[model samples]
Target chain A: MAKRFSAEKYVAGILAGDRVMLSRAITLVESKLHSDHELAQEVISQVLPHAGNSVRIGITGVPGVGKSTFIEAFGIYLIQQQQKKLAVLAIDPTSQRSGGSILGDKTRMDTLATNPQAFIRPSPAGKSLGGVTRSTRESIILCEAAGFDTIFVETVGVGQSETAVHAMVDFFLLLMLAGAGDELQGIKRGIMEMADAIAITKADGSNKDKAKVARAEYQNALHLYPRAASGWLPHVSTCSALQQQTGLNTIWQTISEYLQLTRSNGYFEQKRRDQNLQWMYEAIRQGLEEHFYNHQQVKAQLPDVAAQVKEGKKSAFAAASELLGLV
Target chain B: MAKRFSAEKYVAGILAGDRVMLSRAITLVESKLHSDHELAQEVISQVLPHAGNSVRIGITGVPGVGKSTFIEAFGIYLIQQQQKKLAVLAIDPTSQRSGGSILGDKTRMDTLATNPQAFIRPSPAGKSLGGVTRSTRESIILCEAAGFDTIFVETVGVGQSETAVHAMVDFFLLLMLAGAGDELQGIKRGIMEMADAIAITKADGSNKDKAKVARAEYQNALHLYPRAASGWLPHVSTCSALQQQTGLNTIWQTISEYLQLTRSNGYFEQKRRDQNLQWMYEAIRQGLEEHFYNHQQVKAQLPDVAAQVKEGKKSAFAAASELLGLV
Candidate 1:
């Protein structure tokens, strides 16, 4: 709907760190129109040379876990203390009603929203009949090309979105509440083990002792897990954005130490390289499956076939073959 | 390669619980020849009507976790105490070397291997250039149709195979070694959460106290995880396949309780149905990717394209588009 621009202009603007043009280009990337898609691809290819400069971190917690406040504190700390320009994006597939998220992303945290060093975008409502077509991975590239040295991909921890977030980010940060009562709150089955670090949010007041105990428990629990592929051990820390942002510096230091160790061992670059190939294969799989499932014949027959397979009237492989045969 | 029989005969033999015919059918399913594949499909379809009657359980542990001994004890226990016919199959993709596993699965478990009420099959060595082409899933169907009351899919703990076994089974049993030093020994990242029950193996002699402590610790750890989708809490127990088979009776009792609870609440059938649909989709994805990657044009260009993408010389999506275009 906005004025169209040439791919070269968009590429130059993003590589030169022009925020206005970068925002407009992201809109183009998120656009569902066919022409817009072509323009976005062209821009992406041109800017690919300048991307991959930022550290991509994925943050997640249950809704009540003070995610917005933690992000605000963390983002501000990065800007003021670390001198890093930060871009925060989200991968919420369920956010189909785009307007609410736009308002929430911009206004959820007061200081970070207006900070020149922070570029915050809500989850893109690219919910087409097919699916969310505007990939968060592409958005990460766009932000990196725009000269953001730090990137955060925030996802609600209760859904499958964390897996997508995990695949794209270099380090995953999981926020949790202290105490066992909240164990069932705001997390999925395999997510806790995926964390590069666990930060117990709201670790002030009466909860401070509880938070410390929780940290020790979680650390022991995480230690029981086998080593992560990167050879970095996941630790648990206690922090409260509400109370002087305690333990914030430790979080940053831990990350810096991880960066130093992984970079020294060459896992940082190796992981990124492997991630690139992984995403390529993932994209191919997603594209092929989308094409198959969205075919007219499949759209009509899937429900009946699924029901039959579910009811044990037909076998899974046979039904799958029937669908593939139609394709 | 041997004489092929009619699908009708194979199906009849399988449904009639003929062990010789069942072994031959499983052999046919494992055959890599093209004609064998078609016949396997026919036999699978014909037996589909009688499949899904057996209680499928997945058992996993590291090499040192007494998996073979535990399975032997458990298998014999089921045969003599519970009067259940059991079939054991494995999903070791690396079992192509085959010698070590044969020694472990057969010779290491002398009594169970000789037990008339049990059928044991080693992992297929169909590790052709394509990798693990003979599916254990098809073998599961053939075994089930052969009137086995209990099915166990055993997997080496520290690999991708556990996820495959987890997907097909109704209950997942993970074996763990006692002591904090062995914390990283048998456990993988998310495998603990996937377990319906965890048995601390080798819990006899001096390790008994440690195993009991471990049982409590693991029980607490398992409790900290969010409930599995099935709504059944994961239980932790201490078992010594070596001594008195002390906890073996409890394992059976736990499984019996699970079966009673789930069968009554309808989650059992619902989960099986869900598993069927999930596997169908997974099979489709695997098939589609296999077809694409195996294409002559795609194969020729894939390595160069993959290297380029991995080296950051090309965008992943763009490289994917190039390869997909070839396909």
Candidate 2:
């Protein structure tokens, strides 16, 4: 085990753009140990100034949607084009019985993990919407500090909770299987409503025709949705990740165009500014909730109050009022 | 508009076992209009004493999992054998802005809706978990008051966000498609961990053999999870909603077995008792948060503080402390 550096040193490393130190700092922040949490916040406080320089993109899809493969191919394309250094943060929020993580991102992203120009961090410890790690926002800051101009937040899209990830990122991409389920039913309104762009994955030789049809259907569906503030229409496209076809450049080009359109119209900067506020407020709210519920007295009284209300001996309103000392 | 009845009259109708009044009161409560909300809460208060009488079951499955078809068939089975007055609060949480519900249950449960002994209410409006109406908890009380012996909450298997429905019900049954995706990756861990029983839906005709294999796989996978308090081994079974198969009966049997085992061991009553208190506390907490955040000053100031924290001009901890008057 590496001798853990102090918070100040870790913060200094991140600001100094040391990739190795930035990785270590993210790990420290993601640790559940109480002492590590305190230090994590300290490191975050010091590195916060260097954030907001990277474009945070959130990618989500159902299982077997080729998310890992797509990111790998996409990351390679960006590097080849010398666009900018990239960082990938994959968060698995579920914990085992012992509170340990089963960090599985590295195994999934075989190609991306080996890229020297990319910084890939897999965190399974944090709890946030979309399985995003608690330290992800801070980690993005560190990545930006370390000169990564683009950050990709990849989420396991089994749940309808993708909105959580959508809120944090600059652009939201949803991947889908070609001709999976009823073409209309395959895509949900909630997911479609949030998507800035939709991509039909696994569009190889055999699936190309189906992918094209799916793309057309998605395009029609996108029209039903209120136009996103990006002013640029949400594009529905197809890509074959296995073939390394590298259609990601076009995707990035679309994103750049969307950003330009939205920013010129005062939506892009406004949305980012709005999101940062939401992020901070939610963080504070969650912290306070954790404290309130964890209080021993509250926990002890909870069961009894629940029973009374359930039995009709007490009204939910009165019970709530009394419990909160409003009466 | 119908003249609003006194809360006492609503409670009286509930205790007298009138399903129409039971549903009407629930509708009144779930309405967002201020007057309806006030009357609804009053009605709830009056009927509080008559609740806690029925078996509450939660059913959830993926799209095309034949959830509506199965619920209809199973509901008929329960009425035939037990001759029990059964009520279903089938929740469709999302509705398109065009005011149409594409996947409506009332349309699918055609036969069950007309059954004299069965009362099926479809799609209450609210933004929240799919399995639950915003007022589903309150509706359960109304159903219990209305002399229903079994109340089923039917929800499509969406994702983890639907866990709110699980928190309120007595038994949770997860309905899965036979070949939707890799079974291991399709249903999230959090959902599988919380389920009381797993049932593979669409197990009729061509899918029968595959459903069997899926059930067996689920049974094997379920073994890895910790036992629920019911002391019932999480049962994995298959059913075809179209075949009017004994699937629903088997589901009921499993639930009964769970209730018997847990009730005998004092777990069932204890858990219900605990739930009552949890509801009261959660209500109060949400109420307070809503009220506090509703303050115009607080809402306006939040964005400014957020920007400061994001830019590193102010620390989140410090900003939160000052905002909440903790400093």
Candidate 3:
């Protein structure tokens, strides 16, 4: 019965900048309460015409890396300047055993929660990529429909292997702490090679000196990375969320300069096209994974074949072919 | 046809402890050249009863972390003790981009390759976890059939996700370098928590002091982790692979003690059983993933739904159900 709601009505509300409706639409989409996914797609179709104006930023770091604090401070800065309507979407990577998230970022970012100009949503990172939630890219569309010009997609740092988030965001910012010896060793060259910007968080008080040293190291490393397709050199800087001022102006200025250069050269459009292709590929891969695991015939035979394979009585290839009836 | 290889003949040669025929059989199994995986499995089944006598050890660390150097020194130590049968397998994670490896371990471990008692195989990771070749587990079984009592699975420590090697090995060792500041920050909690032993590599010369300090830091961190199922504490030590004699004895001693304690208490048998179960689970997951992605109908419709979701024209969940025929 709930699935019968008009998708067009919700999408119209979203396009008209109704926040409550947008929130409800995203909830319906993210929920596994039932497969209301198809109906939600109809609503999305009505809302697509209004998206694409927002700058999508992806933020990631390990737990307790002050991701929430950073987002709250950054969100407030954008709202205060009345530069753009801002939204913060944090995807928490949960423990597989407990199926519960380690942190609920909204609870930690109280100031941002109360600000009308800022919309903050915390999502459990289900079975999707490490950085973005299942409905994140969709949620971004809704936010854009509701007139949000900047969207922050924050993820619990997954160490290396974060290509998923990189594929979806316009700017990928890596947050780190100072005194992390030989910056190159702490985070591998592969990860550093992907960052558009690296910000040393907790740059206040005793960590200030360490932050300065880290900044210098990162600056040197950035020089080693090939120039981004956007034709802008990756930048590194320090920021202190506690003081509510940590060279955010410099960050904004740098980003603006990057966007200006890329947009003028048509690189921004090409990037969006590339992102669309990437998302399509991930969607197909994920969709197939869901199908194969959920098939009735395969599910029934899995346990028996698994037992044989586990006991070393059968090989994996033979077992796999049998499971799919290719034998 | 290549699928008509004689399993009886291969089994006869293997039980007689003929390493030449055993190596040939393994080569047939690892070959993707023949479109038949069935013939290889048949040969493997005949040899299965003679397997499981080897102590499977997994060693991993980041690239440039001296993994090959350590394996060379360790493998040589086993051979000198007249344990002449030592097998080394290094799984390359970069194989997907580069069609096949150059198999360069000989250059890296010149001494060990010259030892008659030792056999080393460098395998491409392909799409497998830990960048391990698909046949690695099977290869270990074949190595045991050839009378090799100690098998080492070495993988490039790309990130925290290389836990696949741990699932198949009797003992899991993580290699680290010293002076990795805040020592805690340098080690990812995911990988560190799973390690059974933490060995600080490159511990000679100026690096020795840093190694000692890192050992102390890791010792404190190890205390926080629960004891192993065998009631053994995770060990922290230092090693210099280039020194050849630095820490190989400690590693062997630790594994021996673990096996002794667990064997008497029946924990070792149970642990092996659990590993079998884990392997089955991984197989099922991988099989299902392949099925879903390879399904013709599912592939054809997924992109349209994805595009709709991207444009905010459809909710991902709703679109998925419709494509899956649930709606």
Candidate 4:
């Protein structure tokens, strides 16, 4: 087990922009121990006042989409050019099963890892989606309290983690390869609708022309979609991490424009407030389901009841009623 | 209250194709009384063995998209031309707030309503989405057992009801107008991906060319989406209910082909099994939330706690933890 600290000490350290204390507090948040949970909640409550001051951006793409490289280049640009303190975190619930996470190797982003203005934390291993999401959310608050002005929560694009990431972030950016057909199959449906912007990665050299075609195709496709409640039309652009100046500036520019629009329109604050309420309800749901499913009677009967339900031998509502009656 | 019937009587009446008993049983399913709920579950369980023999289809479109006329024409075609017993049901959870429902006026589908072979049931008057979804799901079973070989579950395309409808159907058919841009805004995001087929409605007269264009556009757009798990690519066709032969047969043919493909590939049965299990879990979730929110302490403290979470004065997770502790 990791060493622990008082909630006050952790809060003070975070507010003072002490990275070591922030990391320790995050460790406590990720820990599964009951005692750690209490301490983590306490620390989170104390630091909550200092949070919500940063822009949380969710970045996702399928495995071969150059996510790490993009983040590396983007992180450097943010710190050097934009004069922003950036923190990178990930939510990879499948990491334990996959034996490693997308951000597990810090060397993938060696330069950014070494940069003092950027903080990068890999996804916690051996955790469920709920656990990872909760910790990542708390870690964002801790990072914000520690003086970071920008946050990027990364997730593998082909999984359920994107929805969780989308819920927590102020903006959702999807990365895509140039070719739309074969490579597009790797992305899940409904994801396109959630994206605030689509970035066509590896848009240099031979891929440049193909990237432009894909961008136009995606732009037209997005136009067919219903307008987002935020009233912002999703933007599609091409960028290359190798040639940092090519589309990186455009990408950041788009984000900044989005921030200005949403903030001025009051959507940014309204969305954040809605997100806050949504998470509380989500957590309550998780807690209730956990309690019900973990009940000895429910646990024993669920398999049988579920089997009956699957076979259509029992009405799902009646079966559910029977199970709920148990606890 | 309507006169009560024994569970065996209801089951026998349903299996014997008594429409009056089927309607009464549905009324019991839609009731809010504790006694009616108990009786409804018993009837559902007894009739469960006679269910699952129908092709349950979900049809949805925005308000101005000729949904009622299309369903009326489609229902007549299924019953007269195809010689199939049809049950048409609506799931308008917004009925209570909207002052009336899309299907509330039987005159909207006068011909279908008068047909001896067709069963038309409007959305229950005043119920939560959960309540309507559960009762509608049960009503489908009742209709199936009453010898209806085809079921059409209709919903206005602009709301959350489509997801519920999608979860309960074998094939989801989305209706659209010839002109896609202006009218398409009324559809909720993610609804297009859920469709098994998109029917461009009102293809008669001057709308014919526009409908053809819309069909091609949607077909091209659907190709960019990740292939559905059913291995059936969604089909897009133009239809005109006014001129019944225009595209109605093509729509039915597409549905028939989808049914053939999915059934042969085992996706049809697999999806039904998954849906059954999904509804069970959905019910459990609803029950848990209802119990949690109705707790005296939770009911008293939720507004204050929620305001704090919404204002960022408390971390959502921490607030959820506090509320969960009280319950």
Candidate 5:
């Protein structure tokens, strides 16, 4: 049997900026055992005071959009040029069955992975079921407490997880390919609106002109969408991650301006506060669902009843009542 | 003291197409008292078999977009030409504070209100407390049982209620004006993508050219959006609610076409099934929050903790934990 972890020691180690302690705390958070959960909550409570100081950014793009290459160069730029400590986290809920992290293909981000100032943690099992995302949220606090000032959460563009990532991050960056109509065909429309910025990746050599054209087109299309509550208009730009001198500086500048405007107007703080309330409600909702769906009767009857619903043999409300009754 | 209402009486009356009984059943469902809940559930269970026969449509637009007039003409057309019974319902969460239904100004929809084939229920109090929407969903079932073949759930353009209205309806329509940019200035961005059809209202008289131009522009803009899962491209058209021979027929035709495409492709039934599952979960989430927030300790501490969170003196997750701990 494994020895029990001490919550107080974990808290002290994390607040003292120990990376091993941060990793261990994150592991505790991600654990599903009841004892681990109690301890994780305790550690999270103690570390809460030292969190919320980081600028959390969420980046997403569909497969084949050069997300890894872009993140590699951008992460390097932040470390070398801006001297910022960065943490790159992945939120790929689909990876659990595949036994791989969404960022398991680490060769694409080799340089950043080895950087002393950068911390890259692949999502364990690509995804966790139910309350698993609660761990990811906690991991953010642990990272922030350990002194990572710039945090990036990455996700694939073609899934519902973008909304989850959007809720946890301060800025959202969407990557797009130049003149790739097929790529757009696979992307979800709602993801586009959630993005705080869109960057056309791989804008080098022969792709430069097409990337420029794509940038202009996306800019025009974004104008049709309403301005964000923060009064910030999402920006579109082009960058080549493979270039010796990438266009990372301009991207950082846009982020700086956004932070300046929103922070000065108090939108940033207000958004974070709203996010907190949202997470609280979300956690409560998830707990309720787990309890209801796990009911002995509900588990036994769901499949047959759900099939009846799909065949239109039963009204949804009636079916709901029948299920709710069992609980 | 009034005699307790029998669930069996309400169910029988609803199945027999009694409007008064239907309204009473709805009232039972909407009642917040714990005593009414079991009876309401029983009544709903009995009425469920008679429901699911109606075509539900959701209509939304800013206040000045002539939604009432449009519905007035549209409802009349359905009855006179299509020979369909219609029910117009409103979901106004904000109506409570204003002391009336958002659509309490029924004079705008005078013809529809008085028409024998039409049943128009002004939203009671414009909104209710937690799970008010659950009752709205149940009211939909009662309306279907009462033999209304067409259902329209209307919402204001500028609020969060549109998402709720969207969930219960089969088809969503956005009513826009020829050049009402100011009216749309307050509208949110995602609502545009939710529409199955966009109608440019007030197309008669001097506004004809502007309406046509707006239609073309919107048509092009719709093309730029990712295609809806149903594979039916949202239609854009002009309509004149005040004109004797109006463009209402074309709008109906577009809706018919949408229904045909989705029905043939099986997306129609699938969407409804998904919506049912969604509602089940939504109901569960709402229930959990009501329980937690209503906890005596939580209710007492919420304002101060929430204020602290808003002021950035506390982390959101930590504040949430404090509230959750109380519960």
Candidate 6:
């Protein structure tokens, strides 16, 4: 077991931008131990005032989309050109099953890993999506309290994690490879619509023209979509992380414009407020479901009841009523 | 109070294809009274085996997309050309507040409404989305048991109801007005990806060319989407509900082909089973929330606690934990 710290020490250390304390606090938040949960919540509550100052961005793409390379380039750009402290975190629910995670090897983002202004945290292995999401959200707060001005929450684009990441971030960026058929990219349906911006990666050398064509096609497709509630149209651009690092500036410009529009219109603050309430309700739901499903009576009867419902031998509502009664 | 019948009588009448019995059973399912709830469950259980016989389709579009006209034409086509009995239902959770529903007026589909082979039901007024969805799902079973071979669940394209409709149907059809800017159609983002087919309405006379162009554009856009789990690529076509009623055949053909493909691939039955389990979990979630929110302590503390959460004065998970403790 990891050493425990008093809530006051953790709070003070996080407020004073101590990376070690921030990382320890995040580990506590991710812990499943009952005692750690109580201490983590106490630490979180104390540091709550210091959080919410950072711009949180969610970046996603299918495997082979060069996510690590893009993040490295973007992270370097933010620290050097933009002069922003950056926190990089990931949410990979499948990591537990796959036994490997996107950020498991810090070598993939070696420069970013070594940068003093940048902090990178791999996703907590062996946790369910809910557990990972909850911890990641708390980690963002911890990072913000540690004086990070920007947060990037990364997740694979092919699963349900994107929706969770989308809920917690201010901006959503999708990375895609040029020349690959969009259908062959393995992105889940509806993910493209959730993107605030699309970046065609590796847009250099021989791939430049194909990236340009893909960018125009995506722009047109985005045009056909309804305007987001933010009143900002989604932008599409091309960037090469390896050689030119060409389109990172454009992506940043789009995010800047989006933030300007939404903040000016008060949507940014309004959305954050809504997200807080939504998260509270979501937590309540998770708690209730956990309690009910863990009940001895419910666990014993669920399989049979579920089978009946699945076979159309019972109505879903009726079956649900029966299970709820058992608890 | 509406009259109540024995479960056996309701089951017998429904299996014998009595429309009046089906309507009465639907009324019972929609009732808010405690006694009615018990009786409704009993009736539903009895009719459960007789259900799942129909081809369920979800049809949606913005108000000006001529959804009612399209449904009227499509309903007539199914009953006449396909020799199938049809039931048309709407899910408008906003109906109570708006004081109007899509199918509230039978005259909207006068010919189809007057036909003995077609049954048209308006959205249940003054209920939550959950309530309406539950009753509509139950009603679909009742209609199927009453010998209706085709069920159309309709909803306004711009709200959360379409997702509910999509969950309960085998095929999802999106209606769009030709020549109108797609963004101006008020379609919610992420909805187009839910569709299995898109039909461009008002395609007769002067609108034909524009409809053809829109169809091509949508078809092209859809091509960029990942194929559905059913291995079906969504189809796009043009139809005229008023004059020639052109392309209705193509729409039906698409649904037929989709059914054939999904059924052969086992996705059709698997999806139904998955949907059943999903609905059961959804119902349990609703039940849990209703119980928790209605608790006296929770009701009294919610307003202030929610305000704190919204203002970021407290962490969402912490607030949820406190509230859950209160209950």
Q: Give the CAPRI rating of model 6.
A: medium
Off by more than 4 A, model 2 = A1-4, A94-104, A125-132, A180-189, A242-246, A303-327, B1-46, B52-281, B287-318, B321-327
Best by DockQ: 4
lDDT of 5 by residue, A1-327 (tens): 234568889988988888877778887877767667667778887888788899999999988888888888899898999899998887776676543476635666889888888888766753344454577778898999989999998888887788888888999999999884654465676788898899888899999999899999899878877778999999998888666355798889888889999999999988998887777667656655666788999899988887876665665545666777786
**Local distance difference test values of all predictions, in order:** 0.82, 0.71, 0.71, 0.89, 0.79, 0.88
TM-score for chain B considered on its own, for each of the candidates: 0.93, 0.89, 0.86, 0.95, 0.92, 0.95
User: Candidate 3 vs candidate 4: which has greater TM-score?
Assistant: 4
User: Which lDDT tens digits does candidate 1 get at residues B1-327?
Assistant: 598899999999988889889989988877767678778878998998888889999998877888888999999999998899999887666566753354136787789889889998876544642234236777888898898889998877886777777878889999999887575545665787688999999898899999999999889877777676667898889888666355889999899888988999889998898888987887678768877988999999999999999999888878877888886
Lowest-sum lDDT 10-residue window in model 4 chain A: A96-105
Q: A1-327 in candidate 2: lDDT tens per residue?
A: 445888789977887778789888877866656666667767777776767787889887766777888888888888778567889876554443233233335776677778777888876544444224446766776788778898988766655446667777889988888874433233333566677898888888889899988898878756654455667678888888765555676687877887788778987777776666666676667655656666777677767876677666886766775566522
The DockQ-derived docking category for candidate 5 is acceptable
Q: Model 6 chain B — which ten-residue stretch has the worst lDDT?
A: B96-105
Weakest ten-residue segment in model 1 chain A by summed lDDT: A125-134
Models ranked on TM-score: 4, 6, 1, 5, 3, 2
DockQ category of candidate 1: medium
Model 6 / residue A196 / CA error / Å: 3.4
Distance from true position, residue B310, model 5, in Å?
A: 6.1
How well is each residue in B222-325 modelled by candidate 6, as lDDT tens digits? 88876679999999988886653458888999999999999999999999999999999999999899889999999999999999999999999999999999
lDDT digits (tens) for residues B201-299 of candidate 4:
888898899888888988987898877899999999988877887588999999999999999999999999999999999999998998899899999
lDDT ranking, high to low: 4, 6, 1, 5, 2, 3
The parts of candidate 5 lying over 4 Å away from their true place are: A1-4, A94-99, A125-132, A178-187, A213-227, A231-233, A242-246, A297-327, B1-5, B97-100, B125-130, B180-187, B220-231, B242-246, B300-327
Per-prediction share of native contacts kept: 0.66, 0.35, 0.20, 0.87, 0.24, 0.76
Candidate 3, residues B192-271, lDDT tens digits: the string is: 66677888888999888989998998888677645666787888988896665758888777878878887899877777
Better of 4 and 6 by DockQ: 4
lDDT of 2 by residue, B195-263 (tens): 789888878899999999989877876665455566768899888867554777787788889889888
In model 4, how large is the Cα lDDT of residue B263?
Answer: 95
- Which TM-score value belongs to model 6? 0.92
Q: Name the candidate that leads on TM-score.
A: 4
